[model samples]
Target: MISTLTATHIQKSYSFEGIEQTVLSDINLTFTQGQLYAITGSSGSGKSTLLHLLGGVDTPTAGKILFNAVDINAMRQTERTMLRTKNIGFVFQFHYLIRELSVIENVALNAQISGINSTEAYDKASQLLDHVGLRQEKLKYPHQLSGGQQERVAVVRALINSPTFILADEPTGNLDAHNAQALMDLLLDCHKQWGPGIIIATHDAAISSRMTHVLNIKDGVIL
Candidate 1:
């Protein structure tokens, strides 16, 4: 399988009070197409930072992140943004849906941003919503749905563009056990069907155990 993402000697740090603190250090990793990976760590363990770097949301202090063999860290901001929008999907702990938009509309927003016509975007969103068992709630706004439902909508939105990689940060952190399990099941199902590489940062062992591989982050290094 082709490598979808690669991180080489990656390091990330932050400056506070004129002191530099390293969050991630000397990390090297690779994600292949159609693979499912879990990043596990305790609080403040740099899992989220690594995920952000991998998704092109942030740059590494040193080293390189490559998507489809192209260096992301070296790209201009606009170019990186376009690359992310075109090839990467993100799901966070919060649904981050627009309260005013309907469920289907929220999902369609991503497609629209990707330059898909509104009509086709809505059609595709509707299909994805249905696949996630949210067809009945298509017209409901985010504020009108339960937390679980909102997260489900977020997942569909992430997948609307059929991105090459899906990067999720504690996607189930806010859900109850039942809802969390359901969401994980949906993610796994999507992975099996669509074959997109998935890299999720999570603390839940149950979630990590189901992945194709699990890497633990400890004191700023992959273990």
Candidate 2:
């Protein structure tokens, strides 16, 4: 069965020199399985913050992030890390590919770290790369690839384990229009063919319009 991830009564704050600043407040959202969701807002509107909290990379000042009815925030750090590795994937604005590793190695590294045999991991990664049209560049380093190619490799890394969902933060922000659309096309193909839910945080309406749900936020509250 596909998992349901929900954020309830979420709030995030940071203290700066004895002053409290809030990044998100009373935010509540439920992500259904196998659907595309877009969180739309200007920068600082808490889109990225929400993704971080949902992904278990950061804790909320208040509220619980529940996965299949269990509170993820209540998990031990190591447990949370394991859950993230096995069930959740993240794509950031930057590709964040390792400079030293070949493209195939970059995608397979997580699977190998999770205890899969190296040969099995590489075999699986090779299949994903071929599906994403990067088979020819598998042995190339990050510097040898273009920006779009680098980002595609990052997406492949996220999908290595076939996570239940992916949280993408401004994934297309750094790409040109053509490349941005191309990236989205690949994501859509994955969503349909592979059956993973996608939650994308973006400022572009054109991109947001394609999502099944578009959530507009301002000053940290959904509109």
Candidate 3:
């Protein structure tokens, strides 16, 4: 099977007060298309760091991250940005929606950035909103929606560009059980309908248990 993502001898570190701290070390893993992967670890165990590296939001200090066999770290900044915009989707713990923008506008923004025309972008966003059962909420602002509704909008935004993979970090951390389960069901439904790889960094056992692969991260290494 072809790998959607691959990490080889990956390392990430930060320097503070003239001391180097490693967040991840010599890590290696592969994520395949149409698969759901759960990355589980305690707080401060570099789960988010790994996700950022994979999504091209950050670069590793050493080694390589390959997306469809292309080395993202080796690409120029513009190239990497284009690659991310076209092929990677991100869902964070917080719904980072612009409060001023309407729900459909927020979701359409991603597609617009990827060069889709305004009418087409909004149409696609509207369809995605309907798919997530939020069609009526499209004209509402972020502040007007509930927490779960805001997150559902974020998911729609991430998927607007039809990415090859979705990298989610603690996506359900702030949600109640009912909303969390609902969100997970939507994610699984997306996986079934679309073939994008889903890689989630989560502490929720209920979420991890449902994934096709469960990886444990301890002290920056895959265990």
In terms of lDDT, the best-performing candidate is 3
Question: Model 2, range 1-223, lDDT digits (tens) per residue?
Answer: 8788899999899899999999887888899779899999887788888998998988899999998888998998888888888789888668789999999999999788677899999999999888767889999999999877887788889888878898888888767887688778878877887777899999887789889999888886888
Clashes of 3: 0
Clashes of each: 0, 0, 0
- Score candidate 1 by lDDT: 0.87
Per-residue CA lDDT of candidate 1, range 1-223, in tens?
Answer: 4657999999999999999999998999989979999999899999889988998888899999998788997888899877777788888667689988888888898899899999999999998788767879999988888877887788888888878889988888777888788788878877877788999899999899899899999989999
Error of 1 at 108 (Å): 0.2
- Model 3 clashing residue pairs (backbone): none
Models 1 onward score TM values of 0.90, 0.90, 0.91
RMSD for all candidates, in order, please. 2.0, 2.0, 1.9
Worst 10 residues of 1 by lDDT: 86-95
In TM-score terms, candidate 2 sits at 0.90
Judge candidate 2 against the unseen true structure and give its global Cα lDDT, from 0 to 1: 0.87
Residue 76 CA displacement from its true place in model 1, Å: 3.4
Residue ranges of candidate 3 with Cα displaced over 4 Å: 1-3
lDDT of 1 at 64: 94
Tell me the deviation in Å of residue 118 in model 2.
1.9
